[model samples]
Target: MSGIACAVGLLSSKCILSAQPQSAGRILLQYTAVRYRRKPRWLGTAKSKLFRVPERHQQVEEEVAELKRLHNVYHTQMKAVRRFLIDEVEASKLVSRAGMVIQTPEEEASEWEQIQRINEEWNRKIGEVREKRLADEREQRKNYILERLVAKEQRDQENRERVEERVRLEKELARNYITRDNIDKAIEMALVQPMSYNFSIDLSGNIRRLGEEQNQESSN
Candidate 1:
């Protein structure tokens, strides 16, 4: 097939080169006849022969058709190549954009971590404040209990003192009443000594001594 294609190429090249001379010779012959006014029958026959050279014309036409087909094919192939190149360029652009997107999360990761750490620190500080507040409340409660206990003890002491004072006043009032009665009885005994026994004054003094002994025993 390769040898056949080579032979066809050689034959087509020779025919194109040969067709130019035939065309020039036919033109010269026609011009000479026209100038001499002696038209030859062989010239007319040659014109017919030239016209009948359809094999060469057909060959030329076929060559032209083949060339046009080859040009169209080459144009289509070039278009396909251009499309593939454009697709490759667009794909590279997409890959570059993806690379930039991938770096964003990595670049900001440290800042996110810092934010989390700050939040944890704030939470710890809040917890500490709460613990301190709770401790202060507990201390306040303890102090309140101690103050209440002290106040209660002071009140109990005051109540005991008031009871003791009431008892002392009652004893003093009874003693004063007993002393007034004893003196009055002694005066009556002394005035009636002549009318009654002469020893009534001594008897009155003895009764007073007995009352004093009874008062001393009641005090204890």
Candidate 2:
């Protein structure tokens, strides 16, 4: 086939494919041998086809008859619906006008007072709820602060107790501590005792001091 004919066929196939369900995966690729440039607006139609007449597309008789029937039915239904809506609107307006009553000055004042009372009742209810919510929030905040203060006091008490325990321990150990006045006495006691760290553990888990075992064996 010619390039132009192939292009037209491909374009028509693409249009048909686009209208089909997506499960069909058919694709058509268009190709052209020569690229044509568009004519400028200043250049009029070619003189060769200046007087040619275009042919009209013929319509089928069945399709024309069916289209005309559908159009007539649609127009008739739309007209009926429009008239029904217009009548309903006019009836509603009349009913409303008839039901409306002209109020006297005293009646109007009474209605206004009733509306004011209702507004005031609603305002008072809202105010009570707001105040209660604010009170609950304040109470929660106060409790939180009190709890923090109590926890801080407990922590301070624990710290003071720990300090007092350390001070008492230091005071108890002060009797053995080597100060300037007790340095000579502490040296003399250490020399007489001669402390030893050499010890042995037997299979029975009893500790035997090396110096004491040697002294006992020599005495025996």
Q: For every model shown, what is its TM-score relative to the native structure?
A: 0.29, 0.53
How does model 2 fare in lDDT? Answer: 0.83
Span of ten consecutive residues with least summed lDDT in model 2: 14-23
Q: So what's the TM-score on candidate 2?
A: 0.53
Q: Candidate 1 residues 131-155, lDDT tens each? A: 9999999999999999999999999
Model 2: per-residue Cα lDDT over 19-67, one tens digit each:
3334468655444443234433444555656798989999999999999
Q: Which runs of model 1 end up more than 4 angstroms from their true locations?
A: 1-116, 174-220
Pick out the ten consecutive residues of candidate 1 with the lowest summed lDDT: 27-36
TM-score of 1: 0.29
Q: Give the Cα error of residue 60 in candidate 1, in Å.
A: 80
